[model samples]
Target: MDTQATSAPAADVTSLPPVEVDDAEAALVEHYPRLVRIAYLTLSARLGRHRRVLLAHRVAQRSLPRGRRVPEVVEAGTDPAYAVVRLATLRGALARADRVDGWRRWARSAGNAVPVPPRVIGLRLFPRAGGSEELALDRALARLDAPARAAFALRGVEGLDEESTARLLASAGVAAPRRAVRDAAMSGVNASLLVSGEFDPCVLQARPTDLVRRRQHVRAGVGAALAVVVAAALLGVPGSDGGTEASGPPGSAQAALAQALDPASLLRADATAWQRADRLDFASWPARGDRTGDQALLGRALSAWGRPGASVHVSATAGTPSTPPAAPPRLLFAGDVDGAAIVLLYDGVRLVRYAEPLDGGSGTALDFARVDGALGASASAVVLARSDGNASYLTAPWISGVSLRDLLSPSAAPQAIHRAADGVTDPVPSAQAATDANCGTAGATWPAIRLTPRAGVPGLAPFVLTDLGDLAPAHLTYATGRGAVPAEATSADATAAWAHSACRLASVRGEGVRTVNTWAFADQPLPDGAGTAQWLCTRADDWSGDDHVLVQFLPPGSAPDTPAAVSASARSTAACGPLQPGVLSGVLWKARDGRWYLLGAGSPEVASLTATGGPRSTSPTRTLVVPARQTTQAELTGRLTTGGTLDALK
Candidate 1:
């Protein structure tokens, strides 16, 4: 048996000499399992048990120094070697937990470049199960944040006192070590519970993962490999087209390929097509980019659309197919913008944007979005370039005016924004701006592009579009009253209603959103003649036909931009949409007289409302009011006029 892997003796450093690389290695080797356990407990529990196990071992293995170098001396009364390694382990786990945002997440999504521990096929590994006390400890640790978990693990498992744990946490770059210690103490778990064998990752339970399903998957993989081998062999034959052609006859493939690459075959609309066209969409867009006449660039882009190279980064919105177009695609734009050569193409169903570095570098990017039935407001703009948290748009040809509007400040006049001759607007702050700031605060502003179509364009309304980190910006629409149909949100009432709900858009950013409709479903009167309140529902629909709905309550006398309290929210449901057409939600409100009340409201279809739990009350109408406390936790339900029961939106 390997003693280093199986056992770790307690370190005695009362009279140890100055530490070196070899000393660190010795300490790491003897205490490797303990260090792994510490990292496992410190890492975020959201990563799941298998990944946490592997990541903990990987972090522990990398904690040792690479070469013979002088190690930094830690404070007295502790082994410098163990202290250095422990700090490194804690820092690595914390960094991993915090890397789920910003560019790191983008890089991982685009290229899968985020480093991860090796994964085992058809096997799962987890720490051996302990008794109820150990399970309670695990649950308690999971409830705390990463920093607090680190504090607890160090103080408990490592047998360190509060001062040592704080010092170690500080050395590991924790900003508030004392606060983290306090949070850990408040977890209501005894520190001794953390030292149990249940938390020991080195003693793990291994199990095979779905053996029957794995066998089926293996057979399918083998069949796929065989098919690839046969296709390669056929392509190697002389006088063959090298598998470049579509699945058709010999000459038809050549004809299709020629048409796809030929610029003259592209459907270019006349500059004044919108004035005479019956349908107002991309079909009326005239090719306007500077490089539209560059045949070589267009050819390259066309070829890339059919078959992108291995280095090309290709992404598509949900429900958007990445396959090649069946016919010659229309060229919308092809120009050099912000150091990148961009080409935009539209087949009747999809909008494809292909971009490559202007310097001829390897960072080529291709994006696809579904615009099959886009018309009017939905087809008003497409994102031309997004860099440094700002986005520029290529507006439709009929758009004669462009301006920036802050949805959170409806009273503010629309600010004029610069638009180029080619119709590309100047860079405006993207949705990322709202997410980067403290949401719902006064500083958070959501900038929306307001487009004004030329006069005499029937059925076209001036509308606003906001970038949601996609090739196409999501259209914003609104409705004023209950059971009203949503329309272009350009009226003052719509703008004012959106002001209280705009900050909620941050939740749906970067989610392939296509359109967001805000509807004021109900207005309720407050108790004791305080004032009236408004209940609004904002539904964000994604490209995949799923919707995210949020119901908010706007109290009387709130600031114009004050974010409304979220009463309820749900995903992938039609609770607040035309399908369901009914929504019920409640909020605990404090009146001006220092009395708390439970306020509930439902859509027009709701005949009665009821409040349970902390406050029990019922109303024969669509609104409910009851006296309550600040800490009151209540459940709201409604009975529809059609005799069906409804629960509050979750």
Candidate 2:
């Protein structure tokens, strides 16, 4: 638009001046040299080195407006001139490229057709001394598909931050570009050593996030619990439809269901249903002949409902066309209620039958696309929504006649989900077979994986979080929250130690093939709060997924009105109690009687402690299980392992 040939230094373009199109264009023109280098290196592998220089020039100039009017920059934080020109360039190149992957593009030309090793891509962009390694790197870059090549070039080569690279690639029309950038960067870095001949790039282990789709549903549901905590405590719980079933195309039943319910409205309806209905049917089954078939179990679930100030409202855009299901498509509804968040499922006509209150405590988030994709291949779709509180996760399907209570219970593993019968596998058959075969004696369980450096472990690459438009790196950010990773945490032994120290009870669950490790924290009393203790639970896995606090518990009779104090030392001490040894203390408080009390969740083997009259060691003089509400403590003489925290009961 601004064709005025004026010379000036290049503007950073990080923050372009609005309404100053002429100046912006001039700045971009001045920066063309730098832009060309970026473009050439970024696109060369995909378009082949021969055409890279020409394509780069075209991409830069074409990014400029062809018409008289300059277009407004649609995306925030992007330079209007440069971003437009770069995006245009990418589009033009893609049009000409052969055999480009729609989702992950690559070059199809004979010379650049092989799968490139990521290390080679890195070296090409950031050329170290040219040698066999450089040649190898060139070969690798040539072989990579377009998306991976672009990712490596931008983040790995250009050294752009993930956010910047994702934005640039996304502007160029890549699906899940943010995810792709992260993978490419990590893979590139990991592959750097492979060129040394000591390591094989193919043998490199897959990052957990790499192999599995981040459990967006479960991740989001963690915060969903806080929304429903109050109402859920009083009432009860329960638990997607979209495109198609994995079996083939969408069947009549699946299509009818997707059409029957508006995704957002249906979710709102289900949330409201939990509050209003004293006795309601599970979502898996419609009102068949006017009798609520699962009345008895449904009643137990409903008992947790009926509290004031409960709200799980779906935004207008919720369940919009962002994620389209196929074959036997399932519907997903995720929102916050009361103060917590909840995810509900719809099998067309009814809600998911589980009927348990879904709650993810504070700081919960969801990725709907990942949830849909994980279940995309399953015949009977299973939704992984958080149960009331964060202590447990429910991986049950929305099928009629299925008992959620039994399925969720350890003894009655649902037939559909038991063993390898029904679980997530790679969309690619070969990849799926690799995972299945690896899950033999070495595999801990469906959800429990033993992280090892061995070659045979299933490759766990991070899948794209399609629904996470801007928060694609959320998983990485969460991982750094607690503090630095200790040296011991480098291996499985350290991770297991961390778990046993912090959680009295821990388990793993498989959602569409991705494994998430869940843990329950001991109930610990708030500082200076004699009557109440706190219960906190979390979930995480190796690779990128970080520990998310699933539930935050405040015990009954505790100082509910008072805000909690920051007790870093107390929390650290309780996580792995020196006095308690292997026993993790949930909460600790000193009673007015000068005796200290500790609370915990689950069934823990607590060693006995004895104290008698006149402060002399004697036969157990006093011992009591810390009740939810207690202001007085006479003495400490008994082994105490509290049965339930506020969330554990849920």
Candidate 3:
């Protein structure tokens, strides 16, 4: 058995008080290097390299003495006893340095300084996977919520399991759930390997005496003058030029890095034609460790992924799961009509990734399936789902085209980008089709109802589209008919017409439209006389919200009625007339489940039906209710049997 993997005699020594300061100090002296590395890793991203070194030392100085107050036998051979203490100290030190925003702000700012990678002197948990993996790991770590990132870093980098990880976090004043800790650990390990850096077997063999001398020598070498330079730059100290290095525009190196990683620049090249010639020019990007291979892969992915006549347009802003990526979140755009198979990807700074279209065309009518997108726990394959009667799974290496023909289903589902195909069946008929069949424009297409994708996890939910704009005039006309529409009516006029049609005797005082869940339209609170000449109710429904209309037409002189007021107890109330003793007709709406119902309706004889309170019943009440699904034409037809008007009740 490797003695290095073994722990001290006690597994739970956190609560144990230090029995001997001398013994613990001796052990800490030997483990100082490892402790310093931990502190450096934790603070470097938030504080600049110089400040990180300072804060890291502060953490070590604070942690070493804790061995005396809480003596524990954590030596080089066993798990370090000060692991928990080091993490706690680092968190506190960062707070004191006021570098809480750290490198995070630099990453988001447009033309800031280039990030200095964290330094690693010893210990290789994993071999270098190259700068790409480093970039990937850094992005993954950045996206994690603070608690999750801390829990994951400690558990994975320090080899603490969930239980121990939770305890460590709690000791640092952070409340973490066991499940979240476990999740962070599982998500963090691979990335943490790149982060922890290459382990140094040589450091393991060094004695405490040699490390102490080396530490002192290095401090003496840095000297006061070098510290002064860094402090001056950080403190905005004026120079001979009357400005500091930071006050000047970004240095040439930083400007180049920013340009190389900028997504907008890469996308501009790919706009007119799929094969971006400008991007093909290797001189456009910063020189990479493997420039030849990176350029080749990027070229192939972009060239083969696009279709002729596809117009590239930015679709949505892609964000990672937990933290911001090294580059700003990539901009995801869709190619024109023919390019439905291709989704362009650009890291805010570069076109690092792109999607190649599947071999055969998706027979379904829709080109892209609009679904919620999500990030994976690990670096997962980019999956493609088709309405080709099957879902295809493919993975693109750092720089290559993943053929749709060679698609293979992985044992586990990878993060996918689902695209709906042509000829596929739509759950709800098109707005044109849903309109009254007798209406003149029954076959006309409603651009407002075009299927548009939303940002969410790829495969968890079905891809659905929402209306890009508000309901068209034809749709409103279909719902209320020509009888309700006045000559040259405005949108408000149409609404009033529908209200008057619904309740013939009642004047149209006000009208409103709501989504399925009761989210009001922009014109929800229009004045009594507000009116528009054209169909201007342009409220694009959120795809997740589902575009289902709920019309609430208030009778000229009445208030909206609650469901309870129109049911059971108030059946005998004088205000409720012969209509049904207690039915509400003020709010009439269509439901997705193919049903139409009247809500807050009162007796026709009474202008306003007011309900009196009564006893509650144990049994369910019988009342007309709308199903919360996409409304269909058949249901609308059934409910509007009397020509889209409920005037018969009045």
Specify the highest-lDDT model's number: 1
Residue 414 displacement (Å), model 1? 1.0
TM-score-wise, the better of 2 and 3 is 3
Estimate, for each residue in 1-650, the C-alpha lDDT of model 2 and write its tens digit: 12212222233544544435564467458656545444554454444333454555555555555443343323444345554554555565545444354444423445557533222211112222233334445445545556666666554333455666676677677888867766566543433322332111111222122222234434444423322332212211121112123532234533432332223223223323322433222332112111123334323222212111223211111222221222122323232232333343432322232222334332333222222222311112323332232111222222222211110112322222221212221111111112222222232122211111213213222111100111111111111112122121223332332222222112211211222222223343343555545433333322123222233344546321222221222211122211222222233345676665443332133334332221323222111244333343122233444421111111
lDDT tens per residue, model 3, 1-650 = 11122222335556555545565455456665555555544443434334445456556656645433552323233434454355445465434433534466555444535533333443212222223334345445545555666565555455655665566566666655575576676663473453334321112221122243244334423432232323222212221234445653355433432333333434322222212222222111121111213433333333222211133222221111111122222323332223234332433222222333334443322121111211121111222232232323222111121111000111112232333331121222222222222222222221111111223323322211112111101111211211111121123333233322222101111111111111111121212233311111111122121222223343232211110111111111111111112222333334334454333332222232221111111111111233222232111101222221111111
TM-score of each: 0.62, 0.23, 0.25
Candidate 1 vs 3: which has more lDDT = 1
- The numbered model that scores best in TM-score is 1
Candidate ordering by TM-score (highest first) = 1, 3, 2
Q: Write the per-residue lDDT of candidate 1 for residues 292-378, one digit (tens) a residue.
A: 998888877776766666778999886566765555788899898878888999977678998989998898888988765577888
Residue 528, model 1: Cα distance from true site in angstroms:
3.1
Error of 1 at 201 (Å): 44
Q: After superposition, how far is residue 620 of candidate 3 from its true place, in Å?
A: 70
Q: Please list the C-alpha lDDT of all candidates, in the order they appear.
A: 0.77, 0.32, 0.30
Q: By lDDT, highest first, what's the ranking?
A: 1, 2, 3
Residue 12 accuracy (lDDT) in model 2 = 53
The TM-score measured for candidate 1 stands at: 0.62
Candidate 2, backbone clash total:
77
